[model samples]
Structure formats: C-alpha cells, structure tokens
Target: MTRATVQRWAAFSDDPGGGNPAGVVLGADDLDETGMQRIAADVGYAETAFVMGSGRERGIRYFSPVAEVPFCGHATVASAIALAGELGDGPFAFDTPVGRVDIETRTDAGVRTAAFTSVEPWIEELPDATLGALLALIGLGPGDLDPRHPPRLAFAGNRHPLLVLADLGAFDSLTFDPGEARTLMDAEGWPATIIVLHEHGAGRWEARNIFPVGVIAEDPATGAAAAATGGYLRAIGAVTPPARVLIEQGRHVGRPGLLTVDIPESGGITVSGTAVPIG
Candidate 1:
C-alpha cells in the first residue's frame, strides 16, 4: 500500500476548537479504498479530503469514516487551506466525482480562506410519515417546526435533509437519540440532517447536525446539508429571487462555521466557506 502524507485542519473558524476538523492528504493519487477508509477512521473526523493532480489545478475526493461521498464542503475548505499553506494563494481546479469545482484561496498572514462552488443542485420531497418519524427520533414535533419553511431534502453537490424549527426556542432546545437517528437516516437515503432556525429574514439561517455516527452520534458541521438547505429554501419560495443565503452552524459544538450559498432561480447551487489550519 502506498502510504500517503496527511495533514489536518478545521474549517470555517480560526480557533481549532471552534470549527469542524477534517483530514487532508495532498497528492493522493495512489491510495486505494482500504487505505483511504483506514486513514479516515483513524483521523476520526466527520470527513477527510484527498487531493490529487498538481500544477495550478488538481482533483479532490472526500471520504467519511465509512464512505466516500461525492462532495464535502468543510473538507474542501480544509483541503484548500492546506494547499495554500504550502503552495501559496490563487484559484485551483478541484476535480471531484460530482464535478470539477473551482476553489479560490485568499490568504492573509497565515490564515487561509477557501471558497468553492458546488456542481448544481436538486431537491427531494419529504413525506408526512417520514417527517413524523424523524421528529420523533429527534425528540421534536411538527409544533417545533417553522411554519413558513416546512421540511425538505435539498442538494448542492450532495443530498441533505433540512428541518426548520419555529424559533430560537426550538433551536436552543435541541435534543436527539443518536442511535435511533442513525437507524432512521439509514433507511432514508440521507447522510445527514440539518436542524435550523432561520434568522436572516427568510434567507439566513442557523443550523446544526446530529449524525448517527454509526457507533456514536454528532457531526460538528455538515457542508452537504448546508448546500441542500440553500437549494430547498429557493425551491420552496422561502428565499427571494436574489437569494444569497448564509448558514451558521457548529457554534453549539464549539466549531462555529459560516456557509455562504447562492441559490439560482433554475439550476445547481454554489456553496462557499473558509478554512484555517488547526495543525
């Protein structure tokens, strides 16, 4: 097996304790599936990013401990920051399974900001029964949901199910049984769930995720879900035509994050965020 070089960074916040941590392995053109999975599990972050190709542009892939997802926002950010630390700043091409993405890094001193766009987007309809079951697993109900936004599954390079709560009351009072959440989500074809309480009039929102974790529970911040939420908001008319929404997440988990997403009137969504070295 070709042992790859790895680095770690936490995206969306400066403080190591204030953002989602992700693994980055540059020039990962030789590692196979088992090696990737082993590295991911050992790092034990929600996801890890591997970059291949070189020159001014390259390819990237994201792997969770258990699976390799098409795209991962935070990890993408983390990977860019990693590249910037060694290669200096500019725009680079990230060839992901989902599509070829562009990342522009703006570096000041040692801090790096990785900004990238998702391939396109799509939305999924959530049924009433699924809603009931999900809420039950999370220990929330329809009453806790935001009347204006409703529930939906959204996508920007990957799939995400967004759950909106009525107010800060519902947002601050979040609780869930991780084991049950895993079982439910496993059946739902969703990788993560984003529970949000909107505050940007209609377009801005604050959210957090509670992943099944397979054996455990929790995910500090989820990029795929954030992208999906933006898409859903646009589709459901919650966002105005000029919809450029910001999603704040991971604060509760100490990894405070901000995801800026632009939802177009017609096709795919663009999600952007920053990443800094936690190494």
Candidate 2:
C-alpha cells in the first residue's frame, strides 16, 4: 500500500492552538474512501482534506472521522495554505464533490492567508414542523430567535438551518443531545444547525455550528456555514450589497477562530482565513 502524507493545520487562526484543526493529505491519489476515512479518524480532527492531481486542476475530497462530506470550508482553507507553502502562493481551483471552488493564497506581514469563493448559494424557508421539532429538540423556543433574521435553510456547498439567536446569553447557553441531533441531521439531510448572535456593530457576528452529521458536537470555525450566512443575509436584504462581515467562532469551545466573509451583489461568497501548521 502506498503511504499518504498527512499534515495537521489549524484553520482560521494564526495560532495553532486557537483555531479549527484539520488534516491535509497531499499526493492523495493512492488513497481510496476507506483509506481516507481511516486517516481522518486517526488524525482526530473535525475534517480532513485529501488533495489529488496537481496545480490548479486539483481533485479534493473532504472526510470527517465517520463519513465524507461534500465540502468543508476550514479544511479547504487549511489545504490551500498547505499547498501554498509547498507550491508557492497563487490562485488554485479545486473540484469538490459539490462543485468547483476557487481559492487564492498569499502572505501578508508574515501571516499566510487563504480566501475561497464558494459555489452559488441559496436560501429556503424551513418548514414550520421541522423548525418546531428542531427548536424543541434543542430546548429552544421560537421566542429565542432574533426577530431580524428569521429561521431559514441556507445552502452553499451544503445545507444548514440558520438560526439567529436574540442575545449572547441564549447563544452561550445553547446545549443539545449529540445523539439526537445527529439523528435529526442525518434524517433531514442537514449537516449543521447554525446558531448565530448578531453583535451591535455592523458586519460583526458570533456563530456556533452544531455538526452532528459529522459526528462532531461542534465546529469551531465553519467556512461553509459562514458563506451560507452571508448569502442568506443578502437574500433577505439584512445586509447591503458589497459588504464585508467578520465572524467570531469557537471561542466558547476554547478554539477561537476568525472568518472574514465578503458578500457581493450576486454570485459566490468569499470566505477568508489564516491557517497555520500545528506543530
């Protein structure tokens, strides 16, 4: 069996211990699904990115410990930075299961950063019954929702139900049964339940992603969800066009990370972050 080289990286934060950790496998052409799963499990990160092919024509696959996901934002960022370190900084295109994604990497003031433009995103209203069930399962009521941002199912590369909470207190006190949440997510074909708290300042938000589908209780920094949220806000006219938003996540879980989202009037959303090697 040909061995695959796996490197650990923390995405969305320059500090290795403060961001979401991901495993990046370069030269992964020799690995199959089973091999990737095993490697990801051993790495014990939320997600692992396997890169095949070369240059801008890369084929990328994302695997959690248990299963393969169509796309992963933080892992993608980590993969890009890893590639940049070895192949030099420039634009790269990855063919993901969902669609083609374009990423660019560069270094500024000694910090390497990567920005990815997600596939076209859309929003749909969550069914009342499903929304009710989700709230009940999470021990939250409709009243806890932020009046400005209504509940909606947002999709970029994957689907997640976006719930904007009323205050930091509600967001901080969120708790749910992982088993039940996983069951619900799998049955509904949803990857995460994104709970967000909008801060007083413009373009500032705090988010938590409950990712039971990946067998992860929570994701510190989620690129896909952040992109989806930016699209959702644009669709709902909650934010003006050509806006840039900063998302703070994973702090509550002790892995603080930052995600910057740029939303245009139309088309793909851009999510940017820094990834550093976890030595």
Candidate 3:
C-alpha cells in the first residue's frame, strides 16, 4: 500500500483548542478495513476520515479508534475543510456506508464552514428496558435524563442513541463505562451512544460521553450526534419543525467548537462546522 498523507484538523472552531480533533487521509484509494481501523486507532482522535477516491464520486469512510464506524460527523467536517483548502470552494460528495453525503463549504467572504446533509436522518424510540439498562450502566438515573426529550435512536450519516440532559451541570457530573456501553450498543448494532448536553441560555451546549473502558476524554464536538439530536427534538416536538439551531461543544475540554444543526420538516438533518488545520 502506498503511504497516505494524513492531516489533522480541529473541527467546529477556527482555533485548534476550540473543537473536536480528527484525522483526514487525503489519499486513501487502496486502503482496506483493517488498514483504516489501524490508522484511526493510531491517530487516537475520536474519529478519522479516509478518502478512497476523487471527484464527486469519491468513496469515503470513517473509523473510530476502537472500531470502524458507519459515519462520523467531526471527521467529515475536518476532511471537508482540508479538501476545500487544497481544491478551493466547491461541492464534494462522500459515498459513505450509510449513504452519499453532499458537502460544500462557505468561503465567499472568509474561511469556509463545511456543511453536510445527513443521509436521510430519522428517529426511533428506544425501548424502556434498553433505556433503563443504558442509564444504569452509565451510572445515570432516570432523573438524570431530560424528561422533555425522550431517549431515541437518531441517524444522520450513522446512528446514535440520543440521551438528553437538561443542563450542563448534569452533564458535568456524569460517567459511563465505554466497554459496557459498547457491548450493549454493539449487540444492538449501534456504534455508540451520545449524551446531548442542553443549555438554553445561548442555544449552545457542551457534550461529554464515555465509551466502555478505552478513551477517557470527552468528544469536543460531534456533528453526527448533533444531527440526530436535532431530529429527535423534532420527533418529540421539543423543537418546532424546520428549526435550525447552533450548538457549541468542547468548552469543558478547552477545545470548544461550534455545530449548526438544521432540522427540516421533510428530510434529513444538516450538520455544519468550521475546520482548521492543527499547527
């Protein structure tokens, strides 16, 4: 296999310390699943994107440190920003396992912000037992969860269990064993669960979710999760239809980034963020 030029970028914020960090393999035409998984783990970021080809029909895949993920939002944002830097402003298509995503960056005025239309986003209410088990395994109780937003499985490019909390303080005092959650989620064919930190003060939130027993830090920003959360809010009627909202993530980790989610009345959610090269 030829060497692939892997570039790292911090997504959501113009500052490196303001968002989630991901690795982007600009050239990955010949890499396989094993190679991608290895690369993702090696990068050690939450997620990494591998561009397998070129043009509007390029093949793209995302991987987490522990396993191959169906889709990853932060990595996609990073990859889009990186590509925009080299290829200039234009639309790019990524054929992911979930579906094809049309990506474009805004650069007419200044640094471009990348936006991806999720692959047919939808929501599925989780079972009561499953929700209870998840809450118990994660050391959170029913009260810790947000009653306004029920637990549901939301899909953007991929699927994630959306667990909403009312405030940042509740989110701040939370913990979940990744290994245990992974085992449960894997059995259900889901990669991981997302903890949606909700704060109404500024339509901004900081998110933190733990896996079973591996990576210990919080995910500064999660576009996929954000997309799904937006969908869930619409499904539960928490947010009015056609709501477009902005989410601020990674503040607690000191790498805060912004996430913009658009919930349409008739289609998939759109997630967006700005990505900058990590110096």
Find the candidate with the highest TM-score and give its number: 2
33: Cα error in model 1, Å: 0.5
Superposed by TM-score, candidate 2 places the C-alpha of residue 275 at a distance from the truth, in angstroms, of: 0.4
What's the lDDT for residue 240 in model 1?
Answer: 73
Candidate 2 residue-wise lDDT, 121-184, digit = tens: 9999999988987787768899988888899999989998888888778778888888887888
Q: Write the per-residue lDDT of candidate 1 for residues 216-264, one digit (tens) a residue.
A: 3666767677767767777788777557888888777666877777777
Relative to the unseen true structure, what is the C-alpha lDDT of residue 136 in candidate 1, on a scale of 0 to 100? 82
Off by over 4 Å in 3: 211-217
What TM-score does prediction 2 earn? 0.97
The per-prediction CA RMSD against the true structure, in angstroms, equals 2.2, 1.3, 2.1
Task: Write the residue-wise lDDT of candidate 3 on 1-279 in tens digits.
Answer: 788778989888888767888899977988888998888888888888998776655788888888888888888888887888878877988888888888888784687899988877778888999788877875778887777777787776666777777756767766666667677877877774455566565455556644331463457788888877777777778777777888877766677778888888867788887888887
Please identify model 1 stretches exceeding 4 Å from their true place. 108-111, 200-203, 214-216
Q: Using lDDT, give the best candidate's number.
A: 2
Error of 2 at 257 (Å): 0.5
Lowest-sum lDDT 10-residue window in model 1: 191-200
RMSD of 1: 2.2
